[model samples]
Target: MYKISICVISFVFLFFLSVSLFTFSMNFLLNELTYFIEWEVVTLNSSSIVMTFLFDWISLMFMSFVLLISSLVIYYSKEYMAEDYNINRFIMLVLMFIMSMMLLIISPNLISILLGWDGLGLVSYCLVIYFQNVKSYNAGMLTALSNRIGDVALLLAIAWMLNYGGWNFIFYLELMKNDFDMMVIGALVMLAAMTKSAQIPFSSWLPAAMAAPTPVSALVHSSTLVTAGVYLLIRFNCLLENTWLGQFLLLFSGLTMFMAGLGANYEFDLKKIIALSTLSQLGLMMSILSMGFYKLAFFHLLTHALFKALLFMCAGAIIHNMKNSQDIRNMGNLVLQMPLTASCLNLANLALCGMPFLAGFYSKDLILEIVSLSYLNMFSFFLYFFSTGLTVCYSLRLVYYLMTGDFNSSSFMPLNDEGFVMLKGMMGLVIMAIIGGSILSWLIFPVPDMICLPSELKLLTLFVCLLGGISGYLISNVSLMFENKALNYYSMSNFIGTMWFLPIISTLGVINYPLKSGMMILKSFDQGWSEYFGGQMLYNSLKMNSSYNQLFQNNNLKIYLMSFIFWLIILTSLLII
Candidate 1:
């Protein structure tokens, strides 16, 4: 039954891969092929509601990658989760997540996209809480509610789309590009994407969501869920071009990249550091998309999915061997014990850092070069290069703790790379991580252009890469001699490690005061005043009146008739007066 899940997912992945390859070849040889299936559900007062699925090269390509990674994750889970009692449930939840991502990819209609968008949120919540622990529960809640903001934003977008007499937003994008109503819709959609992508203010949930199983993290954080927002923006690129909202997104996303990169450097948890790396990549994708480079953004998104998934798989292998100790500080000299996993880790890390001729080089380096060519302000330029450097910084830091430094864990701790099932999954992505970028860049961007830029500027990416490597190497070794000095900066360390207190602000700041106020209102009104005035007091008074009436009714009928007549006389006198 455990292996059956992997087989089913593999078949699904193969089917999608075949379709995607055929579509890509066809599109390359001919023109772009976009297939749309629509069913009219109803028409009311000249307005219509329809379900639409638009499958293009972009959607098919992304769907293929998503299914591919999911299959690998499922296979990897065979070893990582072998002893789990609820492995099937976890596999099913993962499949559900992949299906949601596929739905999000294919749907062009705003209303139809909601099905996938909400599905991703709900299924992610399920995945995050799969462990059935308090930490998982809280992380799941945070993940679900944080994404709910985007869900609401999307709903608002659908409402705004009503101005076009239909929910098919793609059809009206061009017509409404300059319209005020369209701008509003675009802003709402951008906000929705920002939340899903974990940009800036909504950034905390990505790392917090690492409470899920490692396989789930590989699929969700690395490739599928976090990239959904970038995909959304890629689809809506036309609507956002030259808009102030787009510029605002560029600014915030740059900050997000910087913030996440900085946070990862100070973080100790292995999964969290990877999670923050994913966050930083997401910011990179969002910032590029905000700059109207949809194709480049999509290109980076694809290459990133390949390498980042591999990275997580390696992290999973390490964590599994470490007996679930996620603190990287406890890991060192692992290359001696787990050569295969260490090789995979270093390879993926290099790809992530944009090493020359690797997967990230073709896309990430190009993106950096493009950013440099543009007229960026001081802040934006600093954000870009510093974030780039930080990528290398953290990657080196991670390597030092995991592979290069002295063996720091218990000498007898059992750890090895004999999990061939896990190795198989990682090896599949390793091939892609090595060659995915070059192939994708050539296929996506066939025509090469000449840049009339200075040699220094052309080599800036390499320079930053070298600088980051040097900085990381120095910081890693220097910290051993200055342990107390490192500890002395407790306040600053907390701020950076906590992601500039963004998590506190997103969780406690956003919800605590309001929740406390709600509790107070419940105490004062529902429990106190409403109970006294509307329930207990009214019931007691009615009971007393009923008792008095019962006592009076015990008298004789003649006395009652006399009393009624006297009361009637008094009423008549009062009415006359």
Candidate 2:
């Protein structure tokens, strides 16, 4: 059973081989083992809709990493869900999510992508609501409905691509330069990617989605669901590089990063804070990709996956031991209790803060160096560095709260790391979270990017790290709201805390007024003028005509005699004429 849970031996072998293959294919055409296999699913008119898979190093490596993360999460879930009556159902849902993500990763065809995309959305909805509680139900609805926008956008892009006689977007992505139809398609695809990645207005669903089981959060937030959009946009880099939309996405994603970091500081829920961190990193990847540093984005994406998965695994272990209480305020100085899990959690947070020699440092530091060298306005520059600091701030704050203070929960309740099975699962990711950054930096880029900046500029990243660490450490231990006096300035604090009310504006603002207006429309139009004039007039006229027409067909004696006399007179008149 344990072997079955850690079912990634083949992928683990391929994971290492990907480095060789990527270098070989990238540097020399002679060693090119790239494969493109297509099956004609159906043909309509002059258009051929085919299911296509491209086996390049990128797809294989990403697929392997995804499977690897999922397997660990599954292994973790084995111990976590051991007592659940329907444990088999949970594993199957996770497997289905993995299969859907595999389809999404390998398929270059838009129609097939949509299939995988919709599968992800549907399966994720089920996973989010696995607890079958009201909170989970609401979260599942938000997750499903939010992803539906992306699904519809992808569908529209696929339909429009039919005019070009191919749903394989990879072929069109390069030729999309200034072509109006292709540009429209590109815009639609971008919108789909944005929604899937949870940028700005679509961001609320991500934190809500944490209502899912922790293992699901580990799998989804780490390597599969959220990364799908980033992966798609990376594949569509050709179109984005040439379009103004890239700049647009840069602005949106920057704000998203800043917003998420801010929200994490204000949040108390353990999983929600981590979820916001994921959002912030996602924004980082998207923003860098927008700036035409796709390789850099991919680098960060891979590294972030490593540490973030480990982080969630540790969080899960803690939550389980805490009897499923996820409020950080309920937890304090947990290091005195669950030392192993605390160590792992602290390592994950440090990596997230881009601490030196960790998995996050290689990718995150490179991203920052490149951004500083690029021609960015002061606003973007401020956003990038400030958001980076906020990441450290929240990460350190979380660490301090968990590692330093007195135990806030019941002292009698035993807290210990006795779950070796869970620890074994985390150990795999923990090793990666330590060394994965350096390994990926070496693998993905055979010829690494060169960055040379002045002393002050180079030190800026370090400076921000120091400053954020200081602030996070200095923060009052009474949680942000009470210590910061947020209750006194309630409205301002609430506004910032709730992601600038984008949730309310996006969910409630979208739902309430329109629904109220729709009710009014129903009353005024359906029950009033249209109903009276259209239905009543038509009904009366039809009823009267039907009454006259019914006499001829009623089989009544008088009606029969009248019809016979009328026909007889008509025949006689015709003969006389």
Candidate 3:
């Protein structure tokens, strides 16, 4: 009952606020209005310590989207975590997560953002480890440590910004383009965003963090934790635009997008596949921002959140019915058993693949067209297009497996779509997945993002999508019928399938040797020599001295007198002699 109350109260309040904010966002955009509310805490030595909040359509709409999704996810979690004893705790953590994201969204100061940023990292770690298992623990640690790297980068940026005698980066972003120290701050911010967004070299944590429950994945991966970096950079894009650091970001973001799409095709876990797609969309967002189109990046972020969350929820529903089996290979004929969930799953997958009229297409198609029009190198062009095809490929693969693939689970499996609680939660997003894009497109872009491209180039997006879909349908049939040849093409499969061994690299490669060295040092010094010579030596010396002192301390006067008499007799004998 408390769960229901918690969900209902929060859901109603947040959903209403989301609607109000969206209304306000439209008005703000039309009026070109922004409000800055600042409270001056103190002034010392020409530095002003202040708290600030910036309210514009961008921040407002983003906040609206976040709260909307968060409310639904909380409602969704009521049923998802019904059996767990610690569900109240889960609800609280998620609330904290949403608040942290709100803080991050509204803040323009580096000092202020850390409160939200660290809160996000801390709360996410709690969510990831909610199950309290070894796998969850490891994943939590990975998520925490990876985000900590970003935290450090942000701290460095703050330290560099100190030269300006203020912590608010909003005023300094443009100045960073000309000043070396300011540019250093920009570079640090870029690095921080990269780590936060789980770009290459920090990409493993996103997939690994699926150890968290599905609702957390739906929230954190879809819109909140993973999108924070892209949001930060979006606000700070003035510095990144036309800079060397931005160029570097572009390359890596492209690689991340490509890598995630390629990896998704090989992945089997339903949550992880969605997580990887989140990674791919993140890369797309980051890449577009690097090209100096922060608006598109932000637009995509909002739209992506809607469908991605839907995808995860549907996946959760499927996994819930499949007896918690996350392996896609174990799932088949799901469309018959769980029609509602399957339909939503395929819809979200289509949205992810940038199907026309879906939430994703409004942003994704525009982004690709923009990328095509930009004066990019051949390599960059290839990465953008190929990654798009891969997105369709993996998405189509999922659709086939869910819709038409043979029933691979046990014969006795009782899959059904009777979860009205879960379905009710998904209903809002299903509407959004279909109509959210058109609404957002109209609002975000008053006119339209008109692109003048050659016919061949114009048709390229559709062409690749079709080619990829055909290939994906064909590949799924061939691949599922045959045995997994992971062993035969060990090298290629291992490299591509394992996110290029990044999980091992991020978790093992980073810590393996240092942990081994720590163990060796622990054995040789602390356990061996230090134990023998330091603590043990002091212990033994103390024990022997304590024993000697015990003889007199035990009120042994007889022994003391006998010793004294013996000495006196010896002295007398010496004198007589």
Candidate 4:
């Protein structure tokens, strides 16, 4: 009830904001409007810190979408978390997360955004560990620690901005676009965004965070948390255009997309597969931003949120009915038992694959077309096309296993869409996923993005779709036994299947050796030679000194006389010398 009321308030607020902005855009053309509420200023140093908010098409539209999705997710949670004892606490944490995201969306200042940045990290850690299990605990730790990297990076960026004489770094982006100091700031911000966005070395945490509740997963993976990095880059896009670090982002983001898409095809866990898909989409966003298409990247970001949240909700329904079993191998012919869920799932999957007329098709197809027109080198070309194809391939593969096979669950298990609250939550998103892309495409871009290419190049997307579909069908239904066996083999399968051992590398490879070395050092130095020389050696010397002092104090005349004679002999020898 509290959730529903809060969501309503948020939805109405964003609704009026959208309407007002749309009306304003019709009368006058404003590039940007910034408002600052002064918080403090140091008189002696002439420095000031203020709460600055930037309202533009990007922030308003993005905020509307965030609020819409969050509202739906909260409504969906009513039934999903009905049995939990701490439902109020859960709702509070979620609302706090939404507030953080709101702060992030509005603010343009480096120091101000940190408030939202740290808020996201801390709240997400709480959400990940909501279950209080070992897996959840571990996932929470990884999520918090990985995001800590971004926090530290942001702090460094704030420090770097001090040299520019102010904390409102957003104001300086254009003035210092090509300067060395701005370049350094851009690099640090990019690094921070990558950690928050889970790029490369930080990629393992996003998947691990699936240990969280499904609603949290839907929100975090879809909009609020993971997109922080992409949004950060979008804000800094002006500074990054044509820079060497932009080229590096293009290369690595492409790799991340490819890696995640490949990893998705090999994953069997239902939520994990979706999480990896989210990673792939993030890579796509980052890569496009690197290529200087900030608007296009943001367009895709909004549309992806709609469909991806629906996809996760539908998945949540299936998981709830399936007795919490998330393995796709254990699920089959679910469409017959749960028709509405299957329909929603199919729609979401189609949108993900860029099916014509769906939400993903408008933004995704345009992105690919634009990428095609760009003057990319051979490697970049391969990465772009292949990653796009991989999206279709894994999506088709998922549908085949879950929708086509015979029912594999126990006879006593009844699967049905009894979770109406969940389905109700999905309804609005379903409509959006079907038409949101087309509508946003019409509303957002004043002029259609230009794509000049050969006929063959223009049809590349269709060709890849055909190839990926065929490949997916063959692998899912008619692949050779030997091929399947090879995939299950220990060495070959493990490398590709476990995401090139990134999980192991991020965890064991990172910590194991360093921890072992520390233990060895503690034993060899702190406990061995240092202890013997500092503690035991000092104690023995102190005892010997005390014993010699007692001997000198002995009340024996013979001892005293012997000592005196020794001193006299020493004096005679010195005199002779």
TM-score of 4: 0.89
Residue-pair clashes, model 1: 0
Best-fitting candidate, scored by lDDT:
3
Candidates' C-alpha lDDT = 0.87, 0.86, 0.90, 0.87
Q: How many backbone clashes does candidate 2 have?
A: 0
201-301: candidate 1 lDDT, tens digit per residue? 99989999999999999999767889999998898898767889888999999999999998898889999999999999998988888888899999899
Candidate 3 TM-score, true structure as reference: 0.90
In model 1, what are the clashing residue pairs, if there are any? none
How many clashes (backbone N, Cα, C below 3 Å) per candidate? 0, 0, 0, 0
Query: TM-score for all predictions?
Result: 0.88, 0.86, 0.90, 0.89
Q: Which stretches of candidate 3 lie over 4 Å from their true place?
A: 41-49, 481-486, 519-577
Model 2, residue 8: C-alpha shift (Å): 10
> How displaced is residue 313 in candidate 1, in Å?
0.2
Residue-wise C-alpha lDDT for candidate 4, range 1-577, written one tens digit per residue: 6645654565456446645654554333245544444545444566444467876667767777887788788878878888887877887898899889888887888887999999999999999999999999999998998889889989999999998988777779999899998898999999999999988878999999999999999999899999999999999999768889889999888999999998887788999999999999999999999989998999999999999999999999999999899999889899899999999999999999999999999998999898888878889889888988898988998998889879887988889888877888899799999999998898777678677889998999989988887788776665335454664554655676688888888889889999999999998888889988998899999999999999889998999899999999999999999
Backbone clashes, candidate 3: 0
Candidate 1 lDDT for residue 457: 85
RMSD of each: 5.7, 7.3, 4.5, 4.9
Model 2: per-residue lDDT, tens digit, 1-577?
Answer: 5433333443344345545544444443334467889888788997766678987767877876787787678777778888777877787788789889889988988978998999999999999999999999999999999899999999999899888888877787676656888878878988999889999989999999999999999989989999999999898887777469888899999999999998888888999999999999999999999998888898898889999999999999999998999988889888989999999999999999999999999998999999999988898899899999999999998987787778888878689999997999999889999999887777676587778899999999999989988877765444554654665656655877799898887788889998999999999899989999999889999999998888667879998888899999999999999
